[model samples]
Target: MNTINSILFIIFFLGIIGTIINRIHLLSLLLCLELLLVSLFINITIWSNSYDTLISLNYSIILLTFSACEASAGLTLLVSLSRTHKTDLLIKLNLLQT
Candidate 1:
C-alpha cells in the first residue's frame, strides 16, 4: 500500500510537471490533465476501499463521469482552435479576440 501511494504521488507530480512544461501544445496539455485525473481517481479508489462498496462505486462513477465530460470539452476546444488557427499551440490561442 505504501508503494502504491508513493507511485501515485510520483504520477501526480509528473502530471503537474507535464502540464507546466508542455504549455506549448494543447494536445499534450490535455493528455497531462487526463493523467492527473487518472492519478486522482486511483487515489480515491484506494482511499475508498475501506468504506462501503456502494459508496466507493458511487465515487468512482462520479469521477469517471467528470473526467469524460472534461475530456470531451477539451477535445472540442482543441478541434475548434485547430480549425480556426490551423495549430494547437496554446500561445496562438486568442480566446478574447475582438
Candidate 2:
C-alpha cells in the first residue's frame, strides 16, 4: 500500500510539473491533464479497494466518465485552435486579434 501511494504521488506531481512547464503548447497541457486524471483514478481505485465498498467504486466510475468527457472537449478545442492559428501555442491564441 505504501509503495502504491508513493508511485501515485510521483505520478501526480509529474503531471503537475508537466502541465506547468508545457503551458505554451495546448496539446501538451491536455496530455498532462489526462495524466493527472489517470493518477486520480488509480488512487481512487486503491482507496475503494481498501474500504471494500461498492459506493466508492461507483464514484470512481463517475469520475472516469467526467474525465472522458473533458478529454474529448479538450481535444476538440485543440483541433479547432490549431486549424485557426496553424499552431498549438497558447501565445498565438488571440480572440481579439484579426
TM-scores of all predicted structures? 0.89, 0.93
1-98 per-residue lDDT for model 1 (tens digits): 68999999999999999999999999999999999999988888887885646688678779888998999999999999899999999897778996
Model 2, runs deviating above 4 Å? 96-98
Best by TM-score: 2
lDDT of 1 at 94: 75
The lDDT of model 2 is: 0.93
CA RMSD, predictions in order: 1.6, 1.4
Kindly report which residue pairs in candidate 1 clash with one another.
none
Over 4 Å off, model 1: 51-53
Error of 1 at 87 (Å): 0.6
**Poorest 10 consecutive residues by lDDT, candidate 1:** 50-59
Per-candidate count of clashing residue pairs (backbone under 3 Å): 0, 0
Displacement of residue 48 (Cα, Å) in model 1 is: 1.4
Q: Candidate 2 on 41-98: residue-level lDDT in tens?
A: 9999999999798899998899899999999999999999989879999987888886
